[model samples]
Target: MSHKRSFVRRTAAVVAAGAAAFVLAACGGDGNGDGSAGHGGHNATASPSASASASQGQHNAADVAFAKGMIPHHRQAVEMAGLAPGRAQSAEVKKLAADIKKAQDPEIRTLSGWLTSWGEEVPAEGAMDHSVHGMGGMMTDEEMTELENASGKAFDTAFMELMIKHHEGAVEMAKTEQADGAHGPATKLAGEIITSQSAEIERMNELLGKD
Candidate 1:
């Protein structure tokens, strides 16, 4: 009977040791963070999809319209900004272009994402007739062409002159968004643009000494 009891004790000890080994092997050395394997790589790493999910916004129909409209608006501003680096001489005018490009470029991406998530077409990419989109200010093709053809100190002066007009137009468009835009993000961006460009217009006027 003593020998029989000893055999049972040995079997129990072996079983407990095996179970502990199995747990340790499954748990990776110290996946105390999670029950993943000791390899540490078994834990779920964050993906771009996860990051994007966190940043994704809940856009309204107004937001969709705003993105649709504002994308073209921002694109035009970027195109306008491009002229200064090549044609203008004033540090002030160049800075204005830089500011517009920096601000609007990211905003464009944001708007694009909103549109994509909504399963909508990117608005400005349409065969858009800008005449219908003329919310407030836009230079005629003739004026833009003339600006493009200019050179020297004249280029700087003309660029500033053109941008002030451009900025005024943007202010008007922003106001329209504040009044009529559907989405909060787009409306908010419109308000921001109005505030920023209005200030820029004032600064440019000081630099150019416009009456």
Candidate 2:
């Protein structure tokens, strides 16, 4: 009876050990599964954020050129527009100048911001003095001075003419950006510039009786 009881006790111990081992194996399997699932979830969350950042930050040489060139170009347009409030005689010319100033000032800020984010140099406040000569349709120092000196109808006519030329240059630059730039926001802005300035050019031509 003693030997039989001892064998029974031994058998029970073996069974208990087996049950514990099975439980441990099951727990280990669950832990590994949860860990892998957690890792996958983390990656899923990170991917879209990374992609969005990359998309926004993407830029090329043409985008840099567009921002750098447009900043000073916009500044010149704003400066030209500034002269109209005091010098222009026609209400329509004054309104056009005001609209030009309002539009281009924000664009200058935006272009500067792009340059800053891209780790490129923002054009200086005085850059138009030297930079204007290289860009298309930019008025010379002499021409700006002449516009500054003139008032009344002569100022109106001159403003319309010069601004028309300036808008043409901007349109050309924007078209180039549309064709070559890789930055999304910059390209979108280039499109907007093309549309708005093209319309303004038509209006200016009409104002000058050239259309």
Candidate 3:
């Protein structure tokens, strides 16, 4: 009878041990699952926060000035270029005008986008007026008016002269941006402006027999 009682007690202890081990394994699985979920949640939250910080922190005052100033400066150039197709005599002059318009219009849009994203005010559509003429390469109201009224070889000559002056101003402004701007994209755009406008300046000088 004592042997029978000992056997029963041993069987009960074995069953109890097995249940404890099963419970521990289930608890460990739950712990691991929770840990994995926590890590995933942290990563998801961190990514956009880091991206927002990068976007917001990347630009500085010089970059803002570059974008704001360039917008209106480019607008005036586009306005000047627009007058060429109807008025210019030389095919080369007309082609140059078209190229100027094509290039500057997109840049104006990009500058405006940057300003908007940075919570800065974009220049108004009429902002290309004489109020901005003090900016590099911008023409006065009278000069734009004169360009509008000219045609044929006269228009070509006037266009080249005015555009050369305008391009020189743009190059100077771009150099300033390159030196002072903190934004990567803005400084890169400034570099591009210096290269392209410098080339255009040389081309226009050749056209005017001033090279």
Candidate 4:
């Protein structure tokens, strides 16, 4: 009887945990009000396609590639940005984080608009293989593990380093899309990512050097 009770308790605990996870995910992320995540966490946003695909104007293979490639790419950027306020050490780091969130959130809304207009599913949730797009600066599983385990200043430093590289990779990919992509709105956003992230990279480098 005791063994059976123990099993029941464990099952109940697991169910509760899962329910909590779902709630947190639905709340957009379990970040602090300051807009930063603690260690390692995924973020969810309203589907960019949910509202804007119908008005996407014209599109082709390149447009599709830009959207497909960029959904995961942008997802990572939002993740990194969301990680900034809590994990970074310097004020500059926090500002960059704020800038990233501010910049990307609306862009997310805009992309959703594009997706809605195009009638494509917003490509937010997926196990995207970075190699398919030739992006190499992505976080390794182990690196992500370390970031998850880190705290305080260590968290800040590591987060900054990883995010800087992440932003650089994004800039490269965005430039490629800007030059070669077919979607009007997406390509415009790609250009913006290149310009914005490039400037941010310079800022991050200066912060890191101080660190």
Cα lDDT listed for each candidate: 0.73, 0.89, 0.89, 0.71
Q: What TM-score do all the candidates reach, one by one?
A: 0.62, 0.73, 0.73, 0.63
TM-score, predicted candidate 3 vs. hidden true structure: 0.73
Give per-residue CA lDDT, model 2, range 1-211, as digits (tens).
9999999999999999999999999999888777766667666777888887786559888999989888878888899999999999889999998999899899988999888988999988878766567586888889999999999999999999998999999999999999999899999999999999999999998989942
Residues 80-116 of candidate 1 have per-residue lDDT tens digits of 7888888877776788889989998998898898788
**Angstrom error at residue 6, model 2:** 35
Better of 1 and 2 by TM-score: 2
Please list the Cα RMSD from the true structure of every candidate, rounded to 1 decimal place: 10.4, 5.0, 5.8, 27.9
Q: Could you tell me which residue pairs clash in candidate 2?
A: none
TM-score winner between 1 and 3, please give it.
3
Go through the candidates in order and give the clash count of each: 6, 0, 0, 14
Error of 2 at 145 (Å): 0.4
Error of 2 at 175 (Å): 0.3
Instruction: Quote model 4's TM-score.
Output: 0.63
